[model samples]
Target: MTEVFENSASFASDLDSKDELQSFRREFSIPQKNGKSVLYFTGNSLGLQPVRARKLVEEELAKWAQYGVDGHFEGGRPWFTYHEHAKKGLSVLVGARESEVVAMNNLTSNLHLMMVSFFRPTKSRFKIIMEAGAFPSDQYAVESQLKFHGLDPEQALIEISPREGEFTLRNKDILQVIEEHGNETALVLMSGIQYYTGQKFNIKAITEMAHQKGAVAGFDLAHAIGNIKMNLHDDQVDFAVWCSYKYLNSGPGGVSGVFVHERHGDNPGLPRFAGWWGHDQDSRFLMQKGFKPMPGADGWQLSNVNILGTAAHLAALNIVLDAGWQKLLDKSRNLTAYLQYLLADLGKTFNDFKVITPEKPDERGCQLSLFFYRNGREVFDFLTENGVVADWREHPLNETSERAGVIRIAPVPLYNTYQDVFQFSRLLKLALEKEHERITE
Candidate 1:
């Protein structure tokens, strides 16, 4: 069936007609190029700002200016427990109890902190499981953690790879790997959504399998947190960490959140890198001599909260909570499906394009990774020239080959419209066609 989209104008009108979250587009300050808003398809890289983020930040700045040291005690709103304000909202997004969630540090930093307590590798069982093509930061953090434990990464890290000629891993293959080496694996740490291929892993199934094999289960939820519903507690994941910058709409390098299972709440014997912020608030001001930790994830915080950052996160989380993630997710699934439909049609009309993201909707998130068979770099440059914002991932297959990368177009539901996806599809087709003409000439 024909897509029925006649022109960009028709698509725009259709977008105007059906956008349930239309008001949210005004809630962000979108980047513009050449006097027009760029067709942004890179929310998976960094989400658009919430209109109220500045105001929230300003509020913290005002408090700091008015009361420097006093801000921690008696400033208006009191910065002492400011992190608690973001707790309820962050918890909701990750599907954990409020006590099980806390916001602090950046993504990789939090990953390291979580590892300090959870990554206990013994002589007999001292291996970690993860994807071979994980984000560079994650890979580096894991490698460094292994080294810190005095274990060689080559010996302690079990990196899973897809079979030849495939972009995504099969769930069965992953399970088999876990079963084969489960007894020797100390921890199973993997991304809830694989960054390069836009593949959403089966967190629940994997966690269950890892636990059955006596391995602790955890996740790097950087790409999964806001893009998908992760019931961290119910999934029985030992622990998980995620950043707020991407789908969470918390701006660049936003504070990260972590989840610790309720089972660990009363386990005071668990080792953690703690600080005054993690101490009991009732006695924290008492300046006690001994270390006394709070219960659950909050006890893991190493220092005072970043008020401005947490405020920005709260500003965005408020919108998420109010919008109802279920509705947003429903829209997200359909919007991505629509984008895929448009891309598939483009494949029939153009010979240069193919989608590398998983074909099953349940197997991926809102982003679709598209590979251009020829002139991929030229096509990317052309897309940028035409005012469309997308991201290209570094290819692990050929670290030196820049042309072998894929363009990632993430159609975020909070701010992106169907028209934006339509425009991206059109622009990509035109760019690929132009590249083909230039190459043939």
Candidate 2:
């Protein structure tokens, strides 16, 4: 039975009072204005910093000062093996074996690195398949990879798009496209959760489809990593990459990671752009002439670990772990659903309001992409000014129309509260009415 929702502050506060994970909010440093914390909902973009990030970063700095270059081997947490520290944390998040994941370059760079090893195109099978509107960085990476192989992107790339009148792709359509182009497809790359629409693709289904077609399957899990749980290992994902800045609360442009299936990760002969750091650890410092790759995802490391960046990442990862993965998952589903219910109730009064993100919890993560037919930007700005932290994106209806815009709101479970969604509902109602009056006047 569905519980009745009351659009009241008391109702929301009561939910918070019953929340077992409410104490986790203190782990993050929430952004504030005029001495009050803003109602943060953009964790899908840049998450709030973990409170321990500063201290962890300072500790690394102290190690550097006290040990100088010796810090690489002399510190409490040796810089030479710093990236190793995050592997276990990342493994649990992505549902991969510890040996299959490693903290490394930023999101895009990791994509390029993964592609170098996974995207081997043949004359007969040279095509790449991906979601139509993947984040721009992934687009550029695919385009350049195709160009490098002397293949025209237009001819070698297949982008799965939404149906004529839809904002999200159907799983059936995605499978059909993969099947149609299976014979010629070299690889399938898609985001685990689409950034713009907040639709969580069925990674296991997509991976199985791609493999059945004999194509390497990979994913960019930037939005899905911390917002949703997935088993990359059991899903048989060939390779994947993600950034820690979003949902993971790892700070802006935080360190990224890659997941290489154990089947592929154990193969030292697999072609990859090698760096000294990726060489066998025991002999890495011996200045080996030949490349001897480390087993698993560590073989893909391009350079020595960034101790400072990994410090922040590990600090954030610890918080997520301490919060308990299943507990956070449960809270995310509940929080996003509560907000969804309230938004739906509030939207009943505004004919122009529409939600483009999928309504099913199983089809989406924690985000809701809201569309406004008119004064979208004005209302977005109004909400921003009134302490609602959300994201804005232009989704024009036509070339001549500016009225169609969207606000991407992500109520991250780690620190966001039921009270945050309650307050947002109230603010949105006012913004809609105020904008309507302003337009009429």
* Model 1, span 1-441: residue lDDT tens: 123444454865575567677777788889999999998888898999899999988988988898888888775568888888887787888888999999998888889988888889999889999988999999999999999999999988998999997888999999999999999999999999998889999999999999999999999999998998788889898899989999999989899988899898557778888788888878987887877789888888889978888888989998988888888887788778878988887888787657888988789999899876555878899999999898766566766554677889899988888788888888888987887789789
Q: For model 2, what is the alpha-carbon lDDT of residue 271?
A: 98
- Residue 252's C-alpha lDDT in candidate 2? 85
Candidate 2 root-mean-square deviation in Å: 1.3
Q: Tens digits of per-residue lDDT for model 2 on 334-411?
A: 888899999999878987678889999999999999987767899899999999899898873344556677899999
TM-score of each: 0.96, 0.98
Residue 404 in model 1: lDDT: 75
Off by over 4 Å in 2: 1-3, 396-398
Error of 1 at 257 (Å): 1.2
